[model samples]
Target chain A: MTKESKKDGGVNPRDEAKERLENFALKVLESVNQIEPPKISIPSRSTSNIVFDEKERYYTISGKTVTRTSANMRQVKKFAQTMCAADFCKDLIESKKTATLREMYYISEGWETGGFADQGRSDRIVEDLESTFGVKREDLGLLPEEDGASIFGDIVIDEGGMEVKATKVGRAGYTIPPTMSDVEFVECGADCVLAVETMGMYHRLIQEEAWKKFDALVVALKGQPARATRRFLKRANKELDLPVYLFTDGDPFGFHIAMVVISGSAQLAYINHELAVPEAQFIGVTASDIENYDLPTDKLRESDVQRLKQLLKDPRYSDDIWQSEIKKMLNLNKKAEQQAFSKYGLEYVVDKYLPEKLT
Target chain B: MTKESKKDGGVNPRDEAKERLENFALKVLESVNQIEPPKISIPSRSTSNIVFDEKERYYTISGKTVTRTSANMRQVKKFAQTMCAADFCKDLIESKKTATLREMYYISEGWETGGFADQGRSDRIVEDLESTFGVKREDLGLLPEEDGASIFGDIVIDEGGMEVKATKVGRAGYTIPPTMSDVEFVECGADCVLAVETMGMYHRLIQEEAWKKFDALVVALKGQPARATRRFLKRANKELDLPVYLFTDGDPFGFHIAMVVISGSAQLAYINHELAVPEAQFIGVTASDIENYDLPTDKLRESDVQRLKQLLKDPRYSDDIWQSEIKKMLNLNKKAEQQAFSKYGLEYVVDKYLPEKLT
Candidate 1:
């Protein structure tokens, strides 16, 4: 046989064995697919504990019970593993690169929590994704929270609505996903569901069950939203029946967030018309309130004023009354916080928004 | 043999040798000190042909120049090295503290030209100084030219007469001490001598050759008696016959300089009250100039203002018109530099002071 077919004991022996094993595994996979596939018995929850109820099917994957008809525990594990492996696999396929099989296996398992268990590792992975695939934390709904909970699942609110926040936690956790049950729940019907967001407000919202239920959801977008957040908000309004009201501090970051939500082009993303939500209104902690409330001048930072003035140059936001109010705040060099409204106590908010109060 | 006297070649030989060297060095230093006796030599112009003559008087210790006169530079360098031993030294010291040992040395050498050489090294030294000492650059002043040239000489100009600046540079080639000549010339009844000041100003004036052709000689007295800058003015009035006038800046430094000339202080070796001169009047750049000329705000730093105000509160200086005027300048944050009267190039100053023909 030619050198290709020869399996002599030399430097090429190990390489030949590895190729043989890979080809054998591929053949086995093909045969496994072809052979009458084993019927995966998905566990079903019956109305009565007796006869089989074929109509409503249930299954468990890595201990989580899911109701989706096509779900199988083994299949989900496989899918999770596949998704995890996809990071490396895609990298390999696109770049003609390859990593150890063990690395691929661990990466697949890592996708169960979207790799957030080890924060440092998750952040690194997200960064790699962003740099390599142009994927944003907001796009993956993996953005950070300002306060409370290590992940979106841990964010629990009582009767008082949830506060979603994002700082510089991770790239994945900044933008909120619209597909989250909470976002859908808020979007569906709940009135006065305030989304007290910090930096990563949108990213966390899209992962919750309450996002769909709100009649009027207050979105406190901190700095600005990425393209994904804007896109989600646009899709959310179009597909769901909720109106988004934005509230931010009377500073550059706050002003920019409102502008992003309403008109949609911020520093990085240029999805202006595609992502802009025309109905979203700027609300609360206005520049006019700073003087009217007799706020302390020292509370205002000159850098903050300088930043706000920079945003006023953007034509998309320049004409906005809120932008003008922000400019006035800068000129006066005074700042007032949202809690400052409580200086007048609950009475002030009631008096100001009494007629329009949902409750 | 005793340990002190033994020349041991044993285990401790190195220590013994070191001890011997130390003792020898100490003895040599002591002998050198006895021989030199720490004499303060006033350098003659011919000391060094290549190097400039003026800087020769700066004190040296063991052949090394006393690089700094104040604790400021020492402190700054110490702090900078302690904080962060990075390249920050250059930026911190240079921009923060403009003058360094080399620049000071150059200044002492009569290189009166502005701008610093070896800016990088100077900057590093200043940064090191600031970092170590916490002294800001603005607090220091270069030694005045006249003071540096004279071996401690003083000059005084009387009110309502021609302005005369007596400096050593004017007597560059003169050999006989001006002090003796002035005493002899005044006693002989010179016709053109305008004033007969105390030994101090008279010495400097004669050195400058200004005493040769003046009008009357006014001899200033301490407490209205026989002597000072005022004695010279009175003598000039009697012998050479000329009207007298005075000029000074708008600050405490200038005020005190004038006072020293008119009233002989005990510290100046003119202790007799008989030598006090009471007739001299104050001239322009008074405290009122602060309000009269709408000067820069906060010219007198807040601390300085507070100190001056405290001084004004004192019973001694409070009611004094001159002191109160100084306080007014501090309050209004206005200052008058002699340069402001001319070099500031204000059209009002030119039109008001200079003749129309010159304009």
Candidate 2:
């Protein structure tokens, strides 16, 4: 057969298809920018050597040419300062907390990793709290009780209340003891004991426990409780029938620990069923307090609401009252902690925890 | 400190780290070919074109690649022929039987998804067997007497007794009626019948009601019968002296099935102690058969032996006889089956099952 006759049709299908494809390619190519010739310039100093063609609106010149000068040093410095200020403001706004003097100092030093200075400064702050405020290192309860004391001291309050204190920043403000170990719970002479936390608050509680001589004793777990601490609390509750009043920093993890005491998680295996007391209540630095006391809005981080919501979703948290309260806090998008007590000092907690009549 | 002195000791750590990384990259590029590439090839040619240079010399390709060429076409045809030959030789080699020309043709083409050409070819073969050899399909009890004429006329028997009779291509094979299911047993005309299967095999017997033929029938089930199948089998076994003959696939599953059949798996739901039969014997296709039969070297797949050994390791399968037999099979790496009858054909089976005196 002839090649043309062998074709499927009279039309040249391949050629027709190629033409259609070329048209589509042309349309796509039209979307891209067209190239242009670079602009040429001549300096006024080379005017004698240059020939200006008015008709063509073109000028020919010698080697010398004029160009815009680069940004001045003052402008550069101003730009940098503006950028730094913008970043600082952004971080402050994002965190909702003012950049501390120490943080600003670290940033100015160009230590992007914040270096050892940040950690050392934090340690110095903790040391100040210990020596200046007469906060016992043992009462700080930094290390895991099981490991004994590493950096921070173990604070065992009367009535099986325990806390870990640490100078270094890590997982918890203080290291928690392993779940397997037993915690020391001292007897502080009370039917019901209030475990006041934080250095200043603990000092006040000790003075109150001595002076008031009330039927209820006040023990201060100055730092976060180690795992053994919870077990000790459980033993105290079971043996002494002393109701546990947990107080901690007003933060997500702090709230979680209080809930852990009330509704034990799988982590606290030994005391899971035994240590958990359903009646434990969050006594201070609540959302209501944040609103009523007009605490610093900066203390409320953006993640606070989300973290509270997650804590509410936990199956272990069975108390509807606590759930509803936490939900309210999340709704308000705010959080408060008794550590704000540091701003007010020891006097504020005494007035808050122990009323004038009780004292 | 002088700026130069400070600069002398202080090198930018990040810059030094980056330099080291660049050096490492250069070294890696130098030895690019020395690094092994993944064995698998990418599926898409377009993507592979961007990532790999086909012209570059690299390690030898491990897998075969097919191309559309006349030589490839010849290889393809040869492969199909080899597979066909393997199928044809399977039974003959296994049973030491000579394949007839017709049997060879049937073996090669009969079991294909589609019906063989000349639809009545199998029927004609059966007719030749009866008319020319004086061996009737009914005499052999290959088909139920009710459907003897139709089945004998239509069924196609390959060198292996696996009969294939299809009305059309790509259709399911015709179901054999229970009466015609086991020709050898039906043709025996014996008083007592022993029907054994690897553990789970009894379900088919019970479903088929093939156990009702003899005065005292044994329905053997391999593997431990689950509660329900076991209960039903036992109820059926109890109704008549229908003793079960449990033949297993000579693997762990087989042994487990027997154990479950004989001693109910208490852990499983629905097991009944009374349903378990104590008299089941481990027979046929034992690991020992590999040695006894002198099977072709490496006939047993490695995976098969591994699985069998694992089954033998099960405490339930640790009986001295069972263990010894399994070890023998492991050493020889072979297995046997009742389906071996299919390979031996009518004469060999007749000699084996029915001697001259019995005939």
Candidate 3:
């Protein structure tokens, strides 16, 4: 890593990011003038480069790197694309403007030879730059699509020069913005943050005033949560010094969603440090909850059985609780949703189930 | 239709719905006590039962009906399931409680032989109850999943006994809740409601304060949009007397989204009267917009071509403007998103494109 990327204190992250880009440009210029081919080395985001960090309890990209040179026919266009994307980032940083990945893809049409054939190509180049500079896409002034994760209760978000209390927002709550680098979490009275998998469960908790009762922040993850949600949760857990708990359906997919928050998905291992909340715990909708609560459930489908078997082999789900739950689900051939608690009553999840799990 | 279902002038809708359901139950009870086999007749929600309403410009269920009898081995379980769902709805109405459709699916587990093997079976049975009683699922105290649509600008939403200014909410805007039956729209200052196809463009307009400048309410449709959003828009247009405009990408799918708002989809023909906003207009992102505005464009994929061809034959797109736009898109084979205007600048959309369209 460069000195600019390593410096954590005093320096502004944006300026540091700008300096890293400048350094990258300077290296490319030096290579162009030298006897060697102009080249760039980026940490590979391939599956082989991902490693499970035992200490941090998250997956991260290892030291494996891929070097691209202008001399190679396959690498020349990619090399040019990297330089073009670097130039775009420099302009975005200088102008103090941001572009969504979609906008970036469209803007690349003006890049001539450096233009991307598809959005996936442009997206991959952005990730390459992110890993190479040891900076986030947000720091480079690139935004992702708007995510649906909404945060409510026991916290104040300093967003766009306004201190907005999460509790004061309507039942839908305050949506976590795409770019959160400028956001500050302040006046947090909550002891824990519950990242819920479904909106129904989240709204139930909000309507029932579960946050007021439990001193917790409720966040609707809305299925496989977008990157913004994960980043927000990680920051909330770290900056607010609050524990994080994930509540999802009693199914394999729900378990994976929880893992994505706690351990980070292998696909995005490169930026897991910024996204993953290693300390986050998985709260129920478990196989045991199905039997214990006598919640209504469906027989596991063939696909569900296959997924359970796969989760049993996944390294991230190797914990004792995960192992036991997966085995129980496979053996029992049943799966239930977070909404299954409604069989008892509308507020059963908020009143009975959550209280038991949280405490 | 029963007289109870037709009595819409003086009686409360919930009470009317309850009465209709009770009438239905009474008829079934009478049939059970008689010598004849117990049977129930319901308006079919199938494609064959759908008819285009030329006057209203929306699809509706025709006079076609399907009768299910308990004596038939193939339909006995469905007949029982329908009866059980009606019973469930009666209980919900009595208790004044609500359950999500997913929750209703799980709750069916206690119905013994009436239990649905999958969520689709349970969901279809609920829809069957809806068409049979001539009442909405919401009226039966059943809610759909939470939608992502958010409305921002000059409007007041009297939600859950509280008056909320849309502009006063945070940047994410006011999320249209699952059940908007109890919500009221008041203090509408906007001239038109812009139902935006993508959240990015919606947020851009809000961030730029376009609502204040143009006196318009910007709503994020978030793709195909859930039922609650459609109902919300229909109410905004009908009750608040604001014109509705759909802003979407220049593609077949985007065109259908606009059409769904203005003309309604055949799949949901039964409730089109309650949800369809026939007065809505399709604003820009047209095929000609690509050339006129010099917006960046992508070539239509195989699926896009196929859909466009299908829409060419669709009765809903028989309008002169729809035909011209679809033909233009097919001839050019180019599609552009609302974000395409970002090539000019982020504010270009809010300042230039929207103002031109609105004026």
Q: Best by DockQ, which number?
A: 3
Which of 1 and 3 is the better model by DockQ?
3
Taking the candidates in order, what DockQ does each have? Answer: 0.01, 0.00, 0.37
Sort every candidate by lDDT, greatest first.
Answer: 3, 2, 1
Which candidate has the top score in lDDT?
A: 3
lDDT of 2 by residue, A1-359 (tens): 00111111233322333343344335334533343221212133333544432332223233455321114543433323323333343333343222222233333333232222333544333233222222222223211212211111122222123222221111111222222122333323345545544433443343333224434434444355544455546554665566666666556777776766666554332214434555555564566666665654334576876787777876554458667767767777766556344234224455654442233
TM-score of chain A of 2: 0.44
Residue-level error in angstroms, candidate 3, position A111: 2.9
Ranking by TM-score, best first? Answer: 3, 1, 2
The list of candidate 1 runs beyond 4 A from truth reads A1-187, A191-215, A218-232, A265-267, A270-278, A292-299, A320-323, A353-359, B1-359
Where does model 2 exceed 4 Å of error?
A: A1-188, A207-217, A220-224, A297-299, A342-345, A353-359, B1-359
Task: For residues A1-359, write the lDDT of model 1, one tens digit per residue.
Answer: 00111111223322332343344345435646877332222122232222211221111112122222114654554333333433343434343222222223223332443422333554444433332233333333233322111112222111113333221112112223221212322212333324333422222232232234332333434345544355545644555434556655556666666666665443223113445666765664666767666532235677885677676765555456856786787677776544333233223433443223222
True contacts kept of each: 0.00, 0.00, 0.35
Give the worst 10-residue stretch by lDDT in candidate 3 chain B.
B1-10
| Candidate 3 structure quality by residue, lDDT tens digits, B179-215 | 6666766577787788899877787787677788777
